[model samples]
Target: MESDYQSLFQVRLANYDDIPAIMNITREAFVKYQQMSGVEKLAALEESYNDVKKDIDTKVVLLALSDGEPVGSVRVEVFPDKTAYLSRFAVKVTSQNNGIGKSIMNLVDKIMVKKGVTQIQLHTGSKITSLIRFYYGRGFYIDSTDKSRGYVRALLIKEYQKKDC
Candidate 1:
């Protein structure tokens, strides 16, 4: 089925071939942010080939494609108890502010609802105020801040109480 954001792209589970292009988009976007902050030295930190490989092994990465070109992506790992952990949400810089992020997230919400998930959760750093605010705008609320995967980050959650089918 086509996502409501069909004009923007199709959001789907990532296939192996999409990883290289997904990594390229991620590197380009993050490196651009690094450059704009005059922290060009941090540009090298955007290397995501290995991270992409790991996410693929974990079966968590989702890719968004526009005309067969990689334009956006996010990853989420589902636990047995109907909660999911999301990470690495991104849209190619050129595609930002066009509702693609919201669209991709809405797609995930719907899918998780169907999967019987009761909530979705993720973490963002205090340094990324904009990202936190964005998640808030999407109905996520700050739950807490704690050591997540060795990094101090804010925990945010969005509960899903799907209507009966």
Candidate 2:
């Protein structure tokens, strides 16, 4: 059976009441990372409703909907310098690999571009080759790596073309 994702999911900015669904998607999405890294408490899995609500107030939180149901989310923090940080990207386990992640990323890029951001940054586990490849395919490159926090993280950056949007 073919999944008709194009006709299924819609993306929109999230609201305060969507925090629980956001956390649920985040938790479900990070499970593989938790099992792979042998870390039981990934930051995404530990986020509080208050934390997410704060993000909703201060940052760009995008939600992907399936039949009006929340199925995925991504958060962005735009800085004073027009550089933005992307984080907590998640798609429900059942919705994975259906272009939901790619769609969210494309939506984020559009959102940042509209905000006049010149670049977007994000960090991921250094050991996660598949994730690195995913970001690479999206035009992000490793700007640096840090291990001082007791785990390796690859800092990736994607620069937007100069445009008057």
Candidate 3:
């Protein structure tokens, strides 16, 4: 029996072989955002296929596939503070607005909840307010702003608390 959203597509742990597809999506989505932000430092956030492959050992990469085609990807890393760092979430531009991003985020939220995480955190350039709003829609709130970094960005955190059982 498949979950309602399963649709013959599985969201599961990514492997080394998925790096190329993951990087392609990442570069395509973030490259232009980098250029338009007047922040050359955005170049530093890029992850090549090799770099993404290395992350497999330290982070959880979840890939969303439809009919065996890679359509989206997300990464979550748990810190010593028991908080999960969610980043590098990307979906093919053509696949936007189809709930792919939401599905990936939901999957990560469940995993973190099971792991006993108290919160999740992510950072994005302040200019990307839409992305921040997206997070907010997902129940996250801006925790602070860090102008001391390469570019003015907001640090957002989402607390995860189990509902009354």
RMSD of each: 4.6, 3.3, 2.9
**Tens-place lDDT digits, model 1, residues 1-165:** 757556646788887788888787777766654544434344235556777887888846788877777888888888999899987777899888777788889888877887888999987664466777789998999889875334456789999997976
Candidate 1 TM-score, true structure as reference: 0.77
| Candidate 3 lDDT by residue in tens digits, 110-165 | 89988889999988777786677788889989888887666777888999987789
Per TM-score, the best of the predicted structures is: 2
**Candidates ranked, most accurate by TM-score first:** 2, 3, 1
Per-prediction tally of clashes? 0, 0, 0
Model 2 collision count: 0
Give the TM-scores of the predictions, in the order they appear.
Answer: 0.77, 0.90, 0.86
Model 1: ten consecutive residues of lowest lDDT:
35-44
- Any idea how many clashes model 1 has? 0
- TM match of model 2 to true structure: 0.90
